[model samples]
Target: MTTASPADELALLTRLRRDLHRIPELDFDLPETLRYVCGELEALCDDVTARYGKDACTVFSPCKSSLCMFFDRKSEHATAVRSDMDALPVTEKSGAEYASCHQGHMHACGHDGHMAMVLGLAHHLAESFDELPRSVLLVFQPAEETTGGARFICESGVFERYGVDRIFGFHLWPDLAMGEVASRPGPLLAATSESTFDFHGKATHIAKAADGADSLEAGMRFVLDAYGYMAEQAKAEPCLLKFGLLQSGQARNVISSHTHIEGSLRTYSDTMTVTAKQHLAELAESRAAEAGCTCTVHFSEGYPPVVNDEALFDLARAALPDLHELPEPLLIGEDFAFYQRHLPGVFLLLGTGTGIPLHADTFDFDERILAAGLETYKKLVRIP
Candidate 1:
């Protein structure tokens, strides 16, 4: 048998990426996507396991959407590499010949590229399985865009069962130079929570303004106070609280009886997130009280911040000479944080250099950049 040359491996990865992109699936209900991924893994791995049903956290269960593949080298410990299998809800407009065939669904966030890189790594492992220093686990996760599938994978106890020592994953980033890889020692991505505030008051005709308790006025006051509070908090540490939607009145002649505000809170630390939410709730209540309105605030438990393991990152930096260190943390959220919380893990960003923001309808990248991602993963798994 002959080993696949670098050119052959690149071609294989490009084909895999395009095939996965054409059948973009969302969340955990990925039948075609899982089938394609598993078919590729079956030929390269020693064993493959498919997980279905509810996660330990009891989150949504899309049957047979997640997969774990192992290559046993008779080693005591294993290194894991993860790739998310979900696609965004954006329609394809990239004009590529291989644009998504599934209407209203596309790989706008580069999951297809991520999967290709990991699959390419699998092929590399098979070519040299006998010489591997430790076993390897390939994780194809679902629901990363909607429900935090990494949480479900962790709860399945696969990491403990495989004796995974450390894990690694990557996101294709448009902001960096082409093929450049980057990460930080800690807090590479922010933790986020969705928040909604409802204000209730009395309604009356405009002629009797004094008799009406205005809910819209209360909402506006809360917004102003919340922005000021967040700005002040940011000076001390990185945090963000901003409202995107505010709904209230219907008629010009009548005072509104209710107002609803929806927003998100993003912070780099759990302590900061909890404290900011508490302060915002107090501020909302205070503003509502001033306007003679009652208010309720709700915050959804979203993904935790993606904090890179310090020692693991240091080791990665020493291993990959091309790896760049990010000067500041990003405000975005990623469920890859769940894996880091379980064991020492490092998340990296591979540059697409296309300058298109993620989740956009026309977002696309050159498949050639995937080779850099594959090379990075190949080196990471070899670390002793």
Candidate 2:
């Protein structure tokens, strides 16, 4: 087992990266993004289908390429390899030559590299399908940032339509050294959801503030107390309790009648995730009632936890470096979890060297891992 060679993988991955970096698309309904995806897969797939999530539809076909082609649809197996397609609502600061032309939108989360790796695999695999023991489905999904696309595609029945037997995916990680693979068999990702709490009370002049319950103050008190409570009670694992935005009080003289809070909660275990959510809801409800205000909580059900199949991972175990140092169930969330929702799949972290966390404007990763990724995907597709 030659694990994975570096030079050959890097050259092709770099080209794929350049191609994807040129065009960054936002959440669902990216026509251009879909076009590139279909165009790249045309020569490799025996059949191509594209439904724009609307009434629009199209047939994808192949174009001429000097690369030797290799797919035999006669093979009786199929699998889904997903790479997110949407960019975040961010501005590009990297003065790179191929900086995003779309204002205020950027691929801050290494999603561009992800697409490149998978598409590189698609082109390579399509040409070498005859050498593969089975078939693979390339899923260029949009809207992963908002956490809605996975379920939409799952509901759309792409997996069932293709008869996919197993699934696999990867994510970019700057926390690890370049080229390292991070994974845990049981749970490599956590279940997460967003929670918003709105508190409302009677508005009254500050001079007569007693006439109305101070909802703003109540909201403040609740947040302070809630954060402390969650910290103390969260499951003994990776967890988070932070509110990114909070606004209240319309005027200094008038008592604030409403306040809204937007934040997220994470827990490695399913039971803990549910329990933590319930605790937050109860605190909000009770606090609102005590202050003579009404409270409503809205929750966004994000991606579920990712649990890799031990058997499938065993086959590629040798390719991973420092496999023993992988973290315990992570509290991060991923839409790729949906692919595993249908079949045996693993979503591991591909090393991008050290850098700022993903989703930040300054976020960047080592492009060198693109080689490790392309070859890894190619090898996976080659084996029986």
lDDT, residue 159, model 1: 87
Per-residue lDDT tens digits for candidate 2, residues 234-290, read 546667778888888889899999999888877666787778788888988889988
lDDT of 1: 0.88
Q: In candidate 1, what are the lDDT values of residues 289-361, reduced to their tens digit?
A: 9888899999999999999999999989998998999998999999999999999999999999999999988
Q: Which stretches of candidate 1 lie over 4 Å from their true place?
A: 46-64
Q: All candidates' lDDT scores? A: 0.88, 0.71
Clashing pairs in 1: none
For candidate 1, the per-residue lDDT at 350 reads: 94
TM-score of 1: 0.94
Q: Model 1, residue 155: what's the lDDT?
A: 89
Best by TM-score, which number? 1
Cα deviation of 111, candidate 1, in Å: 0.5
lDDT score at residue 222, model 1, on the 0-100 scale: 91
| Backbone clashes (count) for model 1 | 0
Candidate 2 local Cα displacement, residue 111, angstroms = 1.7
